[model samples]
Target: MSAVLDKPRAKAKPKAAKSALQTRLDAIFSNLKLGQEKLQLAHQSVEMTDPGEAAEVLLRTVIEDMLPASIAPMRREPLARADVDAAYTGMFPALAAMEGVIALSIGQVIEATLREAFAHLDAANAWMDFTEMGDVLPHREDITEADRSDNDLAARQPAAAETENVAGCIFDAYERTIEAFAILDSRVSDMNSGAAYGARSLVKVAVDATSAADETNTRDNCEHASCALHEAIEVLTLVTDEAPDLAAEGALALLVLAKQLLDDNVGALP
Candidate 1:
């Protein structure tokens, strides 16, 4: 009977304003959400997607933080026409200024890519909305060769043709990734001794890969080295807050790795 009588008392309890500590906690959670949003956007710009920090691994996957360490290697070669073509032809239909041929030099190819990047920038700024990309932009999801369907190649000819802007997003993302890697590569000092040692090991692997005499084997080894350096970039990207030097060192190591690959294979260039 006493328990039943307490129901009326519970209903009569008055609501009260939040306490000072509760208010402070609310503000903290709001700020955290906003910070999380900005961080996600940064990832989208560089990685072409936002895998939000659902876990500790996701927190450091952001390329913007890793960029301070990777810039040098990204600019080392500036993506020769062959390298551009090798990396993107499957998705881009063509990697040069023309169809079925690579007549444009590396300078021309890189300039064209930059032009697309600037145009995208101009349009986005003019509209005052960066997210208004105007079309289905490139994402890492579309990067694999197997993802390049017959439909993409049939979309347009001369991937850089002025009549269509299909390849704009792909080239822009490519340029940004290069810039991020380059920036990170140039500031590679103050790294932890252990991380420095690990980076050196990657460099040694690239050196050994470059020393291969057989053409096919050399190219295969270079491919593996590129993948390894990419993984290193992903790893160092997490050290942006605690030990940025590690991130920078990793970026520089990636540049060295790329340089070795290009230098070793220059003989194959057309």
Candidate 2:
């Protein structure tokens, strides 16, 4: 009778369902990880003999496959404030790597792919709560450090001129402008504001102009790139006015160098 008096076992608690935002964040992080792995594999196995095609394939994978897949869930549920910074930071390495590849690869096809990718990224930014994210410059620094570390092996080899060509210059300028934009975007309480959208549109135009310049090594294209980059600088000034910081200053300086390189090369061109 005493043995039969053993207390009944407590019912197990049901697991709490993950919030939509958490689910979306998990999807994004998973896709990014998978995309990075694919990128690494492509880097190792794919021959650079056909760099243009290789670049196109890689860009397509990120833009069409990875990016869309990641952002699709976020469209349904806004990303949590705590998750936004990590999302952006996680995406940067892949996008930055693709940018470098795009700079190196000579072709017209990659331009459309890049524009599409940027558009997706811009849309994803709409889902983020930048106000709660606070300062994102440190995330940029993390990206820079990762970049430097990744290039450590390459640093042992002969140095490549970063702004050797007009396309390279445009990409360099684009990179700076985007970096500054990220700082501004993070600081802004409302990314959906007209001013923020305008700044983003300017950056998109700059990207389109850069793609145009990259498509063909022509004086006209170079001039277009110069003008677009200049507009980007003006936008950057607005960004700096909104949020003055070292990152913005540094971006402005580098953007000037990129523009100068484009101008010098354009002038030298017949």
lDDT at 198, model 1: 55
TM-score of each: 0.27, 0.34
Candidate 2 lDDT tens digits, 1-270:
576678777899999999765565455555444544554444443334444343434443344333443333232222233335555544443354355344433354334444444444444444443555355323323445555465444433322343345456555545544443444344344434555556556755766665666567578887887898788778766765775433333334444544665676676444
> Model 2: how far is 219 from its true place, Å?
0.9
Clashing pairs in 2: none
Model 2: weakest 10-residue lDDT segment is 73-82
Report the number of backbone clashes for model 2: 0
